[model samples]
Target: MSHRQVMKVLSGLLLGMFVAILSSTVVSTALPRIVADLGGGQSAYTWVVTASLLSMTASTPLWGKLADLAGKKVLVQSAIVIFVLASAGAGLAQSTGVLIAFRAVQGIGVGGLVALAQVILASIVPPRERGRYSGYFGATFAVATVGGPLLGGVITDTPGLGWRWCFYVGVPFAVIALAVLQRTLRLPAARRPDVRVDWLGALLVAASVCLLLVWVTLAGDSYAWASWQTAAMVGGSVLLGLLFVRVEARAADPVMPLWLFRNRTIALSALASLFVGVAMFGSTVFLSQYFQLARGESPTTAGVMTIPMIAGLFASSTVSGLVITRTGRWKAWLVAGGTLVTAGLGLLGTMRYDTAYWQLAVYMGLLGTGIGMMMQNLVLATQNQVSAEQLGAASSSVTFFRSLGGAVGVSALGAALSGRVSHYVEEGMAAAGIPQSGAAGGGAIPDLGSLPGPVRQVIESSYGHGIADVHLYAAPLALVALLLVLAVREVPLGRRAVGE
Candidate 1:
């Protein structure tokens, strides 16, 4: 295929990417309203993010391995259909639990889309020009990041329609993407007479993650972190994880090939992705809460306030992709990105409920720019190091680890935030001479507007500080990625692009 033909195929892939990314961010600003309407607290808010990431993380490797054994086109189209149906189901959810269940289902499709889009591209494009194409992917991501929040905010704030519309809105784009892909994508058949999937490995990994998440989400709030529940969950997770390693090492077709980690680049990239996930997902999930609960902004205003971050993401990804493609000197950008991300998160740590809007914007801009530079580039770097046959596994490996990091980050940070807010609210009640026993109905997540002046102030101040503190925890982890990037060896990219 010529360059024009390649671009034609990419059109459908880009649309699929757009719909997938759109589903995630659209819920960010709408989350508080969803929780309020569905009747839950911070745990529900955290689960909304965690459930998706958890499912995505667990399924990513399966999708990648399957793509290698089965065929890319059929797998990609199936993912699109699953996403569309899950979106419709999510739109009809009447309770937080049901919504969460649907979101988990949605995540399986999202995991497939995220991994396969990259796998398909890697199969078609040469390493040298991947940065350029990846830049387009990054641009698509930024567009979805920008639009999802803005559109979701608008829908949530509308007169009659609510946050449910955010889920419904992406269906048409996904359907069109499915239609376009069926016509344009041409790939050789991928089947092996002796092919086998490592189902035991997948089930063990999912079980371990589920048990661990249950522990992270419930530890402080529902029971003591040092109790028998912790012993059971933690011990079980460790056993299951080790069991998974054993299974992968012996399986004829492992979900995660153990040899891939023998490559220094893959090993370090996976490590960086893990830290990035913990820091990135854990810290950023609460920004809407900061704006709405702490600053008393509406969903629409909160969405608008986040524009600086998305703008930085767009600028950095677009520019870096072009630069890497032109010069083939990609290591500096990775180092620069890690530094900016660490610096950004560190700066954001100083913010509180009363921090000025301009200061917050600057900090968020730095974080987003750093992420844009680092995110796709790491996968590109890894893809450059692997054989053509290992492309899907290699691509999906990076994605799976990143999602893993996100799941842990959201759960651990959610625990930390919940604990911190409860303490602050308790102290505030005591200081204001309010009765401790019945304070705000035992610390239910209050509708800030519905509370009395003194009570509202206390809740706002608590959330403001709690949200800020989690960033401080995450900043050090991002710095760890910076150190890893500094040590990564840069490889020259191929000048000519290829296709299947």
Candidate 2:
């Protein structure tokens, strides 16, 4: 492809990725409203999100592998098409079950968009030049992250443009991305003949992930931590996980190459990504609820409130990426990112129902700065260490772990919040001498709009307190990541030759 064509294709990929990411993040603020209207409880709400995550996790490596064997352009275009269709289906869904199913389809497309975009970029751009462009990709992701909730909130809060619009919003963008990819993306096919995909490994991994996520979602909510249900689910997950690992070891082309675990950089990057995913997805996913329900902010205002974090992300990623490009040093940034993330969580942990919005914004900025410095750089650093032959496997491995972490984090945190909120609400009701029958049906938190002002405030406070407590859970995860990052040896940055 010509340079002009490459830029066009790059633009399309970035836009497509933006839409995919935005769909997920933007829906967060709108979810509580969506769930209440659809008549579901907290478990249903978590499933709506978890279903998408589970599908995305299962399909991500498959997409990466396909990019290597078939063609990046074809996979990316197909993904955009799927995304549009699913987005429409989700928008039209009348029941929570249908919405979750459609969202799962969207997640599959998301997996494709995310994995192939990176693979295509690697195909076209040399690694040295890659850093310069990575800043752009990171910025795109950051903007989507910031814009999603804000846009979701505005759309939800606007009469006649309710939560359903959150799903509908991405369709036009997907169409544009499709047109751009068709017109601009061109590439030589992989030199080798196609090989068989490891369907068995894929199946095993999916089953294992599903089982584990189910365990996380149910543990401590539907059952006690040590109950029979918990034991059965945990044991089943471990067994299936071990079987998946064994299958990967012997497969001709495993979805996850077991050998990549041998690379120290890849290993550490994967581990750090686990923490980053938990901290990033686990925390950010809940913030819209915190702001809108807990802090009495309108959806639009809540979206606007998140800008500090986005700004921090944009500033830190662009600046750090450029500096690394110039100085050929990345480890310091990694250390800094981990430190900032840990500190951000520590600050957020101190939040209460009465905490100031500006204070929350400051903590958020620190969090975004930490994430911007870490997320993409970890993948870039891993790519730097591996040979080109292993690039797809290596890169996908990092993403796979990240997705796994996200799945685990979202499920675990959702379960934790459900438990905490239920406990707190019960305590508040008892203290207020309110009868359980007077509250809304189901022990789940009430809709902010339906409750009496005092009841709403109590519920909101419970959520704020619950959200703040989760950060303590997140903080240590980040600190552990920081220590792991310290052991990663720095590599000099430069333009990578093809197949280096």
Candidate 3:
């Protein structure tokens, strides 16, 4: 395909990618409000996010493997359909349970969209020039990441439009993307008739991840961390995980091929991606809560406050990608990204509710820049090392680990945040001469507008300090990611496709 032709196909893919990201981000600012309205508490809040990540993580490898065995075009469209239906269901949900179920289903579609987009792009474009196009992905990500929150905030804040609009709003964009893809996007089919999907392997992996996440999310609040329940869940998860590995080792067509990890680049990149996911998604997902619950900002204002981070992400990804394309060098960007992310998280750890917006912005900007430089490049590095035949598995394997990290990180950190907030609120209440009974002390997300002044301050301070602690806990993980990236041997970008 010519540059123009590639661009045409890319437009549709980018739009699809936009909707997937938008689905997640758009709900971030609205979540506190959503959970409160739904009569949910902290555990519910964590599950709302964790449910999606868990499903996405579990399903990602399946989608990627299926893309290799089946045709890409139909699968992409099917994913779009699934996502749309799930979004509609989610919008109509009256309770947290129903909403969580719908969100998990939505993640199955997201897994496909996210994984297949990379596979299709790599299939169509050679690695040497892919950096330039991947930059477009970064731009689309920036736009959607920035736009979703702002859009969701406005919709949530607007009279007569409610939070449900956030879910509904993506439908039209998805429709347009589907039509555009039908018109412009074309990819050669790589269908195999004899290959069987390792359904049992996929199920085992999903079960393992689900059990571990549930355990982490519930341990401290629902039961003691060292209790029999903890032992049961942890032991169950480990057993399932072991079964998954054994099944994959013997399966004729594994959901995630075991041999891909033997490649030093893919292995190291996967490790880096896992830690990055933990550091990035785990911490940043709470920023909306920080702004709204801690700082007393309206959803709209909260969205606006996040612009600096997204802006930095946009700039770094675009510039780094362009530079990589021009010079065929990417290691420096990865290393620099690792450093910035670690620094950003550390700086963010120092924030209180009263921290200056400028300081927050600077910290956020650094983190965002680091994320931009590393995210796509990690996948790029893995993709560069694998053959065309193994492209889907290789790409998805890295993505799988990243999403796994995200799922674990969100669940674990959310639990930690809940505990920290409870502790802080209790301390604040005691210090203020208020009875513990006066506080909404069961890890419930309180409505700041309804609280008495002193109580609201305590709650705000609790969230502020709690969220900062989340970032602090995540920084060491980012540092680990940096170390992993340092160990990834840089391979020259090849002009020809792998196995060409």
> Which candidate number would show the highest lDDT if scored against the true structure?
3
Model 2, residue 245: distance off in Å is 1.5
Question: How high is the CA lDDT of each candidate model?
Answer: 0.86, 0.82, 0.91
Model 2 CA deviation exceeding 4 Å by range:
1-6, 440-443
**Alpha-carbon runs more than 4 Å astray in model 1:** 436-443, 496-500
TM-scores for all candidates? 0.97, 0.96, 0.99
Model 2: what TM-score?
0.96
The numbered model that scores best in TM-score is: 3
Q: How accurate locally is residue 112 in candidate 2, as Cα lDDT from 0 to 100?
A: 86
Whose lDDT is higher: candidate 1's or candidate 3's? 3
Off by over 4 Å in 3: none
Model 3 residue 497 distance off true place after TM-score fit, in angstroms: 2.6
Ten residues in a row with the worst lDDT in model 1? 436-445
Ten-residue stretch with the least lDDT total in model 3: 434-443
Tens digits of per-residue lDDT, candidate 2, 1-500, equal 45475677698889899989998888888887888788888778778888887888889888877766776788888998898899989999999999999998998998888778777777777666666667778899889988998899889988888998899899888888888778877777774575777888888888889988988888876778898888898889889899989988998888888888888888999998888888888887777767876787777777888888889998888888788777778899999999999999999988878898889989999999999999888888877876666677677777877787787888888888887777777788889877766664324546677788767767887888888888878899999889989999777766754444
Q: Backbone clashes in each candidate structure, one number apiece?
A: 0, 1, 0
